[model samples]
Target: MYVGEMGIDRPRELPWQELVLGGTAVAVLLGLHLLPDSGGVDPVYELLSEYPLRSVVVGVPYTLALLSANTAVVLLGVAMVRQGLLRGWLTTTLLAVWCLSLLGLTVFLKDPVGSAGTWYGTAHKLCTVANFVSLPALCALLWRRFRTVSGWRGNARRVGVLAALSMVCAVPFAAAFLRYGGQLRATGTVLGLIERCIVVLDIATIVTLAAWSRAMAAARDKRRFDHEVI
Candidate 1:
């Protein structure tokens, strides 16, 4: 059989269009969530709690956005696995844990102000911790692997350095949250801004990995075709 007929096709890459749709949904919904006065919610100090968005009057759009974001993240992991870009059982496990953490955060809303120590509140905190912790751990664990991977080395090194810094920053952010989050008040603080910066970094890390995986897969596929033709 001719090569085109004989060669098995690689699993299809996840379309970037899908990722963009998911990302846009997340961003727009989050912006809307910030509207609605939040009943004097200090966006700076309020932990970006989804509780406000879950309101009866204006919750639907925010809920849809969150679910879309969740599905996008989970789908990204699955795509990496299918493309054989993630590598190893440990890597796969960490990816799955991170995705599960995202889902958990969506399903378990945090307690409202003055109700910080409630059961659901605690559950929300646990999910938050797990989500944040798993991300850095995954980055650290994959650093060396990426550094050595045939086509992904350079991107891996850059991501690894960023990952280490992000983990270090998470320490202070978590501490600050625990200490002052109960107050649910931060009128003139940069801490909330810092927290948002961390969120940006986290999103960057995920996006970088997705892009890297697709690039590597495409390169490999091209090389395979070239060899077959030669």
Candidate 2:
């Protein structure tokens, strides 16, 4: 149902939260990747988990990684509020859990890439699994909300669905490729490439959501303009 139908007041302009959050995130990641002693190009290809623990191990890069990741997830939480998708306590709680999952992966880094037996390594794996699993669940919950918003229909709908599906398949695809293709080692390998692709796909979904929100905000402004002019 429309926000108006529910007697809710809609915002006049698009929320700039996503732009700030996502842009800062991309910049931090790029900056970290470009730092000196960052193993040059070798570290770039390896899984990101290998970076703070195994490779580089620089404090600035490590901290920035966590900050950027958690900040970006704020956009996901605010997206619903800006779009007037807030339903009740259930929606709010789920979104909180989803955001926490994203943040959990940043806690303390891992026990290096090879030593999953360590306490920190175990925590890292749990967080990683939570992040991957919770992502699709968030998308699923947002499905109905997406359809309710007129701006998210048509091509935007297809884009959103495809993006979510890509995320849903990413972990499995990476796991299978790692198991059958070869060992999951540093960069320049199939596993590393697949993992990078998954990151790209995740960013794509975020961008798509931002675009949809902008469209909705624009449409709302135009409607209000017409009403005023009339």
Clashing pairs in 2: 45-187, 46-187
Per-residue lDDT tens digits for candidate 1, residues 42-127, read 45655555444446444555556666777787778887887667888888888788778767766776666565377766776677
- Model 2 lDDT tens row, 1-230: 12343345455454466567667777776676676755343442455665655444554565566677667667655765565543566656665665676666566465543443566555655666566555455555567556675645563465557556666567665454334332245333455556666666667655665565556655665676567557
Clashing pairs in 1: none
TM-score between candidate 2 and the true structure:
0.68
lDDT of each: 0.68, 0.57
Question: Each model's TM-score, in the order given?
Answer: 0.81, 0.68
Clash totals, every prediction: 0, 2
Which segments of model 2 are wrong by more than 4 Å?
1-18, 34-45, 55-59, 86-94, 144-151, 173-183, 186-189, 217-230
For candidate 2, the 10 contiguous residues with the lowest summed lDDT are 179-188
- Cα misplacement distance, residue 195 of candidate 2 (Å): 1.9
